[model samples]
Target chain A: AQSVAQPEDQVNVAEGNPLTVKCTYSVSGNPYLFWYVQYPNRGLQFLLKYITGDNLVKGSYGFEAEFNKSQTSFHLKKPSALVSDSALYFCAVRDHRDDKIIFGKGTRLHILP
Target chain B: GAGVSQSPRYKVAKRGQDVALRCDPISGHVSLFWYQQALGQGPEFLTYFQNEAQLDKSGLPSDRFFAERPEGSVSTLKIQRTQQEDSAVYLCASSSTGTNEKLFFGSGTQLSVL
Candidate 1:
């Protein structure tokens, strides 16, 4: 079985401060990883993905994530936070065994101005 | 071209009633999928279609859930005998490739079963 875990349910950050939301995964084969963001009452928007690439993956909205193979981690990061960045962030993994995407419970990000 | 489109943004159903949700994928998208999302939980896959072929329905929770894409461009998910447990947001997504690369999602239909 394949799964992803988001250790924190919520993350609080101050405007202009760097922020990180953690994610880890367990899979049987190659992991196809992705990050998505959801606003209240809206559908998820794709942020970024890691199939096979450089360790550092850059995405929309000035966001990026570092894929660490040894740690089995893909942590979303932003150089500076903004109030508009507050939303629910989800980490997902596509299992090679099933070819289906498995998603975490999601982490709510709160940015304080 | 428009992104994926789902209809009946909100629906309320009584127990044992039936409901249908619709989705129109982006022009020329070859793959379509339906997922159910419960409160505070991630979306769970319900079914998948490759063109007009219903390729996968492994994730559907029960026999009451049925989906079809006869014309290959538009699809519908029909839930028979609605139950309280069926109350959820039904999300529809599409990808240009059959491998489900970078799926584009719709706003979803919020279903409430009483």
Candidate 2:
């Protein structure tokens, strides 16, 4: 019943350029959203979460995400991309009543130097 | 303290064989979870344990999958009758109590079914 969609499978960006990876969700109740990053052959690391906070939530590695309740969207953004930022990005949403987290398909980000 | 740790970083199992994956959570974490992640996809929840209690097993794909946390600190996930579809990375995560807590994940065991 609850799910998240990441429209793009891959996102390409140049170093020093701003980047955005899109995410949207469908849930029955209020959403507790989060973003995580995974490097090749490694476990996912938490990036940020939005649980009843300002529209824009800042996270690790100079990354941030904007939570738009009306759009049902939580797109991860970075002011300037770095080569080290290239990795798989996942968007997850947890319903208020359930601890089960539904994650998006994930986006592979490539930051070209 | 150390973060969540899962072992045998890699496992190779023949079809129909059984395998066990282990996870050691942070010393005081109360919620432990098991998830399966296929290549290029997000991790899918398998089971959850609150301390030593198996509070949720709804996400487990089949009866062949069993998980337990006997003492509430370490847990193990056992899979039987392994199939090709069973090949994936098994990730374990843990968090403090309360539904909103952030999850800390382990490097995971990469299971390759032959």
Candidate 3:
């Protein structure tokens, strides 16, 4: 089976400070990784995805994630945190053999001003 | 119209009552999906439809859950004999292709079973 793990339930970062939200995955075949953000009382919004090439993938809102094959990790990062970046972040994976995407429990990010 | 649209943003149902949730996908989207999200958890896949075909229903929790996209544009998910465990946010998403690409999601219908 395929699964995603987000180690942290909540991450707090000060404004203008760098932030990182960790994610790891397990899949039988190749994995399609993605990041999504959800604000309170709203639906999830797509952030970025890592399909094949370029381990470093850039996403919306000045966010990026590095895909490490050996580590089986895809950690979302931002150079500087903003108060508006506070939201729930989810890491998802889709196995090549399946059409369904599985998501992690989600990490709540709080950017303190 | 501009994005995936779901009806009845909130629904309250008594135990043993049946409820129907509706979804209207984006124009020309070929793939639609239904997901259930419990409190503080990620969305769980309930079913998938390609056009008018019900391609996958493996993630459905029980036989009481039924979903269909008759004309291939709008879809409905009906739950019979509602239980407290079934109380969650039912999310509807769509993509242009059949593959599980970047999906556009609706605000979702928050269901509460008493």
Candidate 4:
């Protein structure tokens, strides 16, 4: 079974600070990793995915996540945060052997302006 | 529509009632998925459909939950004997193909069981 974990339930950052939401995964084989953000009253929106190739993956809204194979972590990051960037972020994973996409409980990001 | 659509947007059901949620995936999309999201939690996979085939349903919490994708276009999720615990947002997502495809999610049906 594939699973994802977001260690922190909430991550607080200042408007102009760099922010990172941690995510780790467990899978039998290569992991298909993705990050999604859910805004208030909106559906989950796809942010970025790591299929293969470069360790770093860039996504919408100037968000990026780095896949660290050695640490088994895929942490979503942004060089500079904005107040509007605050939202519930989820880390999802799928294995080659499973059809279900497992998601982490989620991390609530708070960007104080 | 260009995106996945689900209805009714909100459903209120008394305990022991049955509820049916509908999903209309993107045109020509080959894969569909159902997930349940409780308040303050991320979506949990319920089932998956490949075209007209119901391939994997291992994520379903119990036998009371059933889903079908007929004609490979429209899909429905039926919950029998609903309970307060069943109150959640039922989300439907679709992808062009199953493997490694980025999923497009619908707004979802919020089911409230009293």
Best by DockQ: 4
Q: In candidate 3, how many Å is residue A71 off?
A: 1.3
Candidate 3 chain B: 10-residue stretch with minimal lDDT = B95-104
**For model 3, how does the per-residue alpha-carbon lDDT over B12-76 read when each residue is reduced to its tens digit?**
99999999999999999999999999998889989999999988899999999999999999999
DockQ of each: 0.66, 0.73, 0.78, 0.80
True contacts kept of each: 0.53, 0.72, 0.70, 0.75
Residue B52 of model 4 has an lDDT of 94
Pairs with steric clashes in candidate 2:
none
Native interface contacts retained, candidate 4: 0.75
Once fitted onto the true fold, the runs of candidate 2 whose alpha carbons sit more than 4 angstroms away are none
Candidate 1: tens digits of C-alpha lDDT, residues A3-63: 8999999999999999999999999998889999999877899999998879999999999
Error of 1 at B23 (Å): 0.7
**Model 1 chain A poorest 10 in a row by lDDT:** A94-103
Reference-based lDDT, residue B77, model 2 = 98
Q: In candidate 2, what are the lDDT values of residues A1-113, reduced to their tens digit?
A: 78999999999999999999999999999999999999887778999999996999999999999999999999999999999999999999998988788788899999999
Candidate 2, residue A22: how far the Cα is off, in Å: 0.4
Score each candidate by Cα lDDT. 0.92, 0.92, 0.95, 0.94
Superposition error at B37 for model 3 (Å): 0.6
lDDT of 2: 0.92
What C-alpha lDDT, on a 0 to 100 scale, does residue A74 get in candidate 3?
97
